[model samples]
Target: MSIRHITLAALATLAAAQSASAYELDYSIDLLVPAAWPTSVVLLNVNPSDWASSTRRGAIEDAADAFLLNPSWFFIEPLEDDDSSIGPNNENELTFTSNSALLCGSSACTHLWYSGTDIVEADIYIKNDTYSVGNTKSDNLAYAGSYRSLQTLILHELGHMAGLMDEDGNYSVMGQDWNVLHAGSTDVSPYLDADSGAGLRELYGTRVGFADLSVSHWGYGGSSGGFSTHERNIVEDTSGVEPWHTTIGGEPYYVLGAGEIYRFEATLENKSDTAYTVDVSIVISPDPIITGADTELVRIPGIALSPGPTEVWLPALVPEGTTGLYYIGAIIDAGGDVPEWDETNNGQYLVAAFSW
Candidate 1:
């Protein structure tokens, strides 16, 4: 959210004016009312003529996609029926404004104009004159120690338009401190962060059973004789074990040696309309032995998966002290942040033949 001009004495006057109005929601005061109903899909009209660079338009689309990735009921649709004009008649408009230099410097403003108690339409205005369009180093940066990008600012403002408030005294896109936010530029990948994404999910709805998780490959002790055998769902194969080997989708599991580094490869397929952040973990348990404590070998951090396939690799070393047949399992969404439609299908396990 951006700053506004409000004098100490002006507060009282504004309160009085709001009380006199017939509308239940006073536009003068800041509130958390949504621009549209939860069931309704809102339309946003981007003024294509305003941006000199095409990247800005792509940035706007990317910002919209970010919100759509969340489990929120609020949805945005671009008005493409009439490509000639952005909008001036009915749809909500997102346009550049050069006249709001007093309210903010190179920041964005969202005007939620209401008719009586219902919000008829809202407008998003960007400070095109104060901010650089394509340049990474914005001359008129808003916060002191922050890397403020135009796309990030637009995403924040869009969050506001979708009936979200600033998580003041916290770190989020809605927070006033822009220094904590990140833009998908250079090494940074665009994300809504945890807090903001959770808030949005709470408001709309949650997604469940949205991803298909699988371990594509697993192996220990480099390939023996420069040959590798891989399978999908096998317990153990101990025939002709020659030091080390690799497997590619084989049903029978290959032999794993003690004190050797093993590689686990897995892939996740997002079945939902939006992206997902998944927590992946590998568990090694007594399989052929079936009598020991299950040891969690490693846990990979949350990996962002778009509405498609994403691959991850985890390298783990087997302790030299342990000597037993174990089964390796790959678990997805270990924290349960994502509501899977099918909880039973979240993990895949395979039995392994081991040599100590």
Candidate 2:
């Protein structure tokens, strides 16, 4: 099934507007109607013309690699070319053609259609006249931004071809460019963000062996003032993890001695629109344990979660003699309690080193 279909004429109009400010605008995405692919493997052909050029070709390769890294069951492979051009063909094609008239003054554009109202194919047109880096003035601050914008554009277009909609916010390349709105904000990698990865998994299924939830921002919560229970309560109330503290995966990790009680916190955000009721299972596996399959020291049942961030806090004891890298993780919606838009992003991990 196809999520969306547009003719070349309409695509040109959209491209004209989109190219105007690859720098500005909060991009929104939609899964075209009748979403989901009929087949598991989709082959694509790249235009020799686009591949002939270094700059344009690099963008194409980067975009392709992003998807290749996480296919979610649907494999998109790029095929070699011959004398034939992108046209009415059985194979999907990505082309860089010079057609200012068709582009409506935009640097590049894409058009897609299903082969039989079920299977899909697409054509990507990059306008040679307008999208040249050599022509862009380096000193023009506003215009100078177009260099990265071009790469972002290529990444964004390839996302559409792969059956994803535009997403808003600073979260993903599928979303708006965060760097433009926030000065000094690091540029978004052309790589797939959490949302994009979740969406792809939802569409095609997990990539053979990958988790549904990815976790980060871990740390231990403890009472600040003294050893007494009342003092511990006071400390817990006053102290919190700082932004600069070292984390296993951008989350906090704690080193506690034997018999110590620690309160832990972490963040979980849903990638899809669908809500799920999950068990937020927390585990402190011994040093050297890495995957979720490792034993769980504890499980917190029936935590309700949806397509956004949820902060989890629970108390646990640091066992005697526990030391080295212990894997602390929170598995949301554990055991498939509720169906999710993407099931692959359900388990997250952090490394906490324990002491006697």
Candidate 3:
């Protein structure tokens, strides 16, 4: 017998301070803990014919690859096409369907069948007719005037299969805001943020002697609320709605002046078990990608971070003679003092900006 588990859809809730990490899990009533896969690896079957566009198929594969990064023992291996249907078929499948009822009023959905705390079977469905799906913002916007990111949607559904609950109102792949356009930008990337990684570690185990630190967008008030790059200059609409803004390379950008100092709060997360002392640096770059080689604005060293999320307030200065658009971001463990499971995710760009 198969038992229906979880479903994903558009569910919204007020933003609240997370007691631990921003990630939540699917609980088992009998075990009183998170339901998870018994084995270290889970096999998934996908038909190439189901996706006519190679780019879309690649995007789906890329979403699966993101979870293999670090601090995640739960791995996925894609198999050849299988004929098993979605519900209680005893086969793990990933496919696209035109049926609106399968989507549950969302672009996609993941259904799982579990026995006690062990997830036995899972199926993922992506709506083909309701929305245009694309790999990039340009392709998406050009194709349908607006589009749904196939990669981002797949990543969120995969997170559900990994035993993670929907984290609405925060900067996470499993968040309710995991659409193509979010917070005035089309930045739904096919990458697992630190919060999602932490949740995976909680169910599985963590990588020893290594930590994954990251920074994400921080906001105040309820769902769909306003957020600011500069803390002192908080921008909010009269009805408490988030203001619309333009983006560069799918990331939201801000406007600032040279030689000005700005303060911003960032959500720093540690996706590991142990605590570590590391340095956090604020930097500026010409694009959305952030690196240690970027122009340094300030560095705060020796900050202790326990496992989970911590609110960090940082101050940055726009250098003189700086003009045009640049990314303002933070790099945790900038000096590489501490070892990490995934060094690529250590740096995160919150706002790309234009300086006058």
Which tens-of-lDDT digit does each residue in 1-356 have in candidate 1? 01111221111111010011110112333356433333447887777674434766766776676556554566666543334343345567777767665225536777665554355566677776433333232321431123445566677777767665554322344554232222111122233433455455555565543333322222211122321121122222123123244542222345676765455544344435467776666677665211113465655555666542344444455557667555666666766677754454355453354555
TM-score of 2: 0.46
Name the regions of candidate 2 deviating beyond 4 angstroms.
Answer: 1-33, 98-107, 115-117, 129-146, 149-151, 177-188, 212-356
Q: Which candidate is the best by lDDT?
A: 3
Candidate 2: tens digits of C-alpha lDDT, residues 218-287:
1112222311010001101113332122433222345555555454555454444455555555566654
lDDT of each: 0.47, 0.46, 0.63
Candidate 3 lDDT over 1-356, as tens digits, reads 01110110011111234433367788754546789999889988775566455766676677778667647678877665655445667788888887777777667888888898889988888777433344444545422246656666777888888888777434566663333221213333445666677788888887666567766554322233221111211212223333344654434556766775565456676767777778788788776677888877777666677766566556566778889877777888888987766677667676767766
Best by TM-score: 3
What does each candidate score in C-alpha RMSD?
Answer: 20.3, 16.3, 10.7
lDDT (0-100) at residue 192 of candidate 1?
44
> How do these models rank on TM-score, best leading?
3, 2, 1
My TM-score estimates for the predictions, one after another, are 0.45, 0.46, 0.75
- Stretches of candidate 1 off by over 4 Å are 1-39, 79-89, 101-106, 115-117, 129-147, 176-185, 207-356
